[model samples]
Target chain A: MLFMRFRHLLFAIFALASGAAMAQNNPLTGLLRSLTNTVAPDQGKAAATNQPTSVMGVRGLDEVALKDATPAPAAVVELEKYAASAESATAAAKQTGLQERTVSYQKP
Target chain B: MTNFRLPVRFGVRFGVLSLIAILTSVVCAPVSAQTFNLNAIGSVVSGLVEGARVSNISEAEEIQIGKEISARVLGAAPLVKNEAAQRYLNRVGTWVALHTERRQLPWRFGLIESPTINAFAAPGGIILVTRGLYASLENEAEMACVAAHEIAHVNMKHHLDLIQKGALTQAGAKLLEMRSGGNEIKQFAIGQGAEIFTRSLDRGAELDADSKALVYVAAAGYDPGACPAVMKRLAAMKADASSLAMLYKTHPAPADRAVRMEEDLGKLAGAPAGSGLRPELATKIK
Candidate 1:
């Protein structure tokens, strides 16, 4: 249902009217594979209900789902400030070349 | 006699303990720099969990193949000679992945030494954008757009799927373990994966990545407009088929890609998107 808003994003999100719809299952991350829709999901489905949760603040979104809380546009200023400071914050990663800078992405 | 004996014993014990502490520092001094590396510790912990085999290709195997492919790519063209530019790329690339679902991948971003306008994503998050393309970016948001696009491809495992399709009979991760120290099968599979990059991904994959990249950039607080902005730039570039054969062959026409995003781009017109593309970093891209 979340994929509805992204209809303009991929034609694959909407399948052919008469043909058997192909589910483009991306098992790599083992997440969001179910979001691939065969038909145009109802625009009014869970949109309003899910809105508040989806764009809840920046890093405070450690518990949010990827589909629901990708990033609220309103959070842009905070995101920018975060990015601006991210370089200086990650300077330790720079000193070591590419040895290992990333901690495992913990699934919230 | 008892007091003297007890005093002597206490002195001897203290001396031995101090000697042990000195020896410990001497032995550990070389690796003192790594004692506080939380990322390394996380990697080791993740590496252990990564050993649990995935269905066809384990995460470890996928990352290993990505590294091999990276080496081949570097061998052919090498990374750009500019350290500042490379660091900027890593900074942006790392930022985008941090907001993605597959954030734990050993993600890396490099501006390979190529003048052709193109970007490549190998499995397990090894993303390379050509210097020609890097020079064309308008700001950090656009850079995030490109990195997010490639990161989306990795999340979808597009290249890994292609490798599997090409070598399913011998490319299973179980086969990798059965023949330990035998990377021939792995090499063959990786070779197939590398070759897949030489060709274009299916239209569905490319379009899907475009959509997700928008989400990624926005999720990272960069401008979603950058997605359409970058595409419009590519659409403007008059790439000759012979000279820019790889870019020409691999990607769907930029016009078509831009067309798909028109509605979303229109919606984002008034949205407050944040981006801080430093002038210093911008000039170093060359």
Candidate 2:
């Protein structure tokens, strides 16, 4: 019975080792491909649009992909509302004896 | 065989008892520390974890953070209050933004009512140009180049990276810890994050943004030479001028930047040498 138990333990260890080896071989390629697909679905479209492709080692900004891009109307409206509300709040705070300090850019 | 079984049982029991002791101390330590007002350890652990989590901020979170920072900036120095000028700036800025990777961002542009010749870009596509800087520009292209530079900073997530780096520090950690306490604490944490933006990004990031700005402007069908021209003008400014001091302090030496741009100018050869100032925009700003 002891010999049988020892054999079972060795088998379990071997199985775990092989599983780890498989995982190492397959690294996160699947996850990375999915992320790439989701983030940039316009790779083909960009190539066809005649955009100034990145030349001087700069990688991120693709002028072609942005050819048809426009600002979101909702975000613009929200920004305007925020500006108006912030203006009113500042005025009210000043009237209530709050000091208006310039935002400091000095290193801390 | 019986003797071997007895030892095995004892070993397992001893190991379980030791683990329980360790677990008890680990669970109770924080409560005991709190009772004694020793929250430094708690804050440190919480801050590091929070900082790591924020390093991978989602697109929506980035916009929210940018909004908070923009509000602080507006509170400090309000918009120029000229509707026509504001509208014109929005048009130009939106046009330039449309030529970059993140064209879909809200991309609001405002001219701040400040005499300091400086411009700022908050995350989520908010760009602010100072009245002094706008007044100094000779043409629409110059203004567009400046706006493009700020946009590059946003697109590259410079401010977000700075805030995340700040989070790893003691002050940042404490602020992050306070963020969980209540709404007031949350506001304070955001204010701290805003402060990080005001301090400026590293020199490398500033240069990278400058390079990207050239690419963006060139791609938008503007004369790429305008970027180096602006840098040369800035380089020639007197260091003591109050308007230039803040800008000078935060950026690399203008002369060095100009030299770098000169080297990279060859790469933008095919970009069109568009008109400096369009007739419609000229009369409005004037």
Candidate 3:
């Protein structure tokens, strides 16, 4: 009876040990472990670096680029003309009814 | 024998119970303990459901999209014919961009021929300033401020984000169904993406870009104040002017921008003193 009891105890121990080993090797457990160990830290690092979350929404500037841009010669001439006009407009607007709001950058 | 059976039974029960406890703990742990695992599962499930939908735009992809947009822009208004002016703008833009985190991007700068007082930034580091806006600047510092502002938009991925959220998501979905039909869907998406430039970014984004532009120009050792100076100029423009209409529509009022810049200036007081324009570049602009 004593021998039989000892054998049963050993069998039980073996069964328990094997069960634990199998559990440790389980794919789900491995995935969970990797997610906790790897993905979490990567996210933390990305956050710390202030990386952008997504880049999908930026495509709209083409229309602006197309609609607003002119050929270089025309653009340059127009720019020169615009500058002269803008200066005169500023002078005119100041002399007339429009009030000029001065925005100065003072060191605080 | 009965005693042996009892010990074996108890051991089996204990082991099974421990396994159950571990499984339960994994399932029922506090969210903080399990969030990563849960997110992994969610990503896998989403990947399966969304099939080929890209969650992030790669750098190569950004360049491709930028190229398509740029071609359309060139179609609308070609680059300034002056090689010297183009080179000068590139030099200045590259100088400012080098000071940014995304310096590795293939930075290209152009002067558009438009008389409109506006600037544009395409994804993957393409920047264009209207000859009109460029001509209005008094010095390189002012030009740097403008370039920096557009650079900020690229760095911040402002346009890229708009495309992704609006057209790209739909395009990606369609591309999966019609693999050989991808080009048509992509072109349609690109057209839709271009339309976003006509719309205004949320006020917060424009203001944020202003703040970032200030920092970038200051970092590049240009007067951060140049940005506000430009804002003041824009604010002073007649709202009824046709040239000013598109700019005003797409941006916050210059008065509001000036106010924001005024607030930002205080924080930038400690930045290094800015340099003036190089004599050669000054003469070239003249």
Best by lDDT: 3
A34-96: candidate 2 lDDT, tens digit per residue: 223224535312212221223211111112211222323344344463332333433432343
Candidate number that wins on lDDT, 1 or 3: 3
Each candidate's number of clashing pairs is 2, 0, 20
What TM-score does the A-chain of candidate 2 achieve?
Answer: 0.26
Error (Å) of candidate 2 at residue A34 is 38
Off by over 4 Å in 1: A1-108, B1-54, B169-185, B241-243, B266-283
Interface RMSD of 2: 21.3
With candidate 3 superimposed using the best TM-score fit, by how many Å does residue B264's alpha carbon deviate from the native? 0.9
- Stretches of candidate 3 off by over 4 Å are A1-108, B1-55, B168-189, B272-286
The per-residue C-alpha lDDT of model 3 at residue B116 equals 70
Ranking by TM-score: 2, 3, 1
C-alpha RMSD of each candidate structure in angstroms: 28.2, 18.7, 16.3
Candidate 1, residues B1-286: lDDT per residue as tens digits? Answer: 9878866866775566556545434333322321121222222233332432234567898887877666555554456767667767877788778778898886777776666677878787778777877887877778888998999999998877765543322222333345553344455556543345664579888988887777676666556777887888877777553324466566788888888865554444223433322122344565
DockQ sort, best first: 3, 2, 1
Candidates ranked, most accurate by lDDT first: 3, 2, 1
Top of the candidates by DockQ: 3
Predicted candidate 2 versus true structure: per-residue lDDT over B1-286, tens digit per residue: 9989966876775566556545434333322321121123223344354535444566776787777666666555567667767766766677667667897787778776677678878778888787877887776667778988999998998876665543333223433345443232223335443344335578999998888787766655556677878888988988667667667666888889888876665554444344222222342342
